[model samples]
Target: MANKLSQLDQVFAALADPTRRAIVMRLCAGEASVGELADPFAMALPSFMKHIHVLETSGLVQSEKSGRVRTCRLSPDALLGAEDWFQQQRAIWEARLDRFEAYVMKLKKEKEQAAAKRPSRTARKKGS
Candidate 1:
């Protein structure tokens, strides 16, 4: 469906950034406060927050504000769609490659059989 495709697009687009990817990786271990998430990067908090915004928009992350602190967590389901898409592509390519290999092998066998049936130059010369 169009909605699924749109979500896939958003997830891929958001993960295209290394910063955002790193954030997701960190969140995989457990949820972290905004400050905790921002600590590892050298960029300003405001700039770092832009990455979080993108992640949130992609549905790859969710955050809750408690008092003045915002904590973020990874949404594993968001990644499932992308994973399914990749698996489908892998299966299709693998099957196509298998068919191609079979075709090549068949051609090779035919050529070998044809060569075996032909007479050698030396044999033809002796006959002449």
Candidate 2:
């Protein structure tokens, strides 16, 4: 569990940067060279490299240097921790909603029971 949370932290931290997020999204298509990744952004090569470095440090992406070019690929497994956390959050919310629904139904039943036990409005008006 600790390991999972750590991974989640890293994933979230890495994705928090817009440039890093864009790099991840691009890698989703397949692998891309650092030069190719930088082409779409207006930032200088050195500045863009910093974003790639963050993604690499977070374990969200891995890069290989071949010849003079560095190619990066998305690491899908790194997202597992984040997905698990989201699933747990969703489950908790669903359970709370279900409990609320049951409580409402119980209250409705109690209301109906009380109405049945009470005298009719017409009978009360006649007596008054």
Candidate 3:
């Protein structure tokens, strides 16, 4: 569990930057050489490589060196852990909301029952 959380932390951190997110988004279509990936950005090559490094470290990307080029590909199932965590949170919140709705309904029913048992203003005036 701790390991999973740590990995998720890294993944989220890697994805926190718009640059890194864009890189990942591009990789989604297919693998690309380092040069191709770096071409679209205005930053220096070294600076761009740092973003790639972060993605590689987070297991969201994998790169291989061939001849003079480094090609990067999105790791298979890289986002699965984060997706699972989100699903778990969604289920928990939905359950809590369901319980809250039931509680509110119960309160409304009790209030209505109480009101039904009480005398109306017209009846009190008549009695007076």
Candidate models: Cα lDDT each:
0.97, 0.91, 0.95
Any runs in candidate 3 off by more than 4 Å, and if so which?
Answer: none
RMSD (Å) per prediction: 1.4, 1.6, 1.4
TM-score of each: 0.92, 0.88, 0.91
For model 1, how does the per-residue alpha-carbon lDDT over 1-128 read when each residue is reduced to its tens digit? 99999999999999999999999999999999989999999999999999999999999999999999999999999999999999999999999999999999999999999998999889999999
As a whole number from 0 to 100, the lDDT of residue 25 in candidate 2 is: 92
Task: Rank candidates by lDDT, best first.
Answer: 1, 3, 2
Error of 3 at 110 (Å): 1.2
Which candidate number would show the highest TM-score if scored against the true structure?
Answer: 1
Give the Å shift of residue 26 in candidate 3.
0.9
Evaluated with lDDT, which candidate comes out highest?
Answer: 1
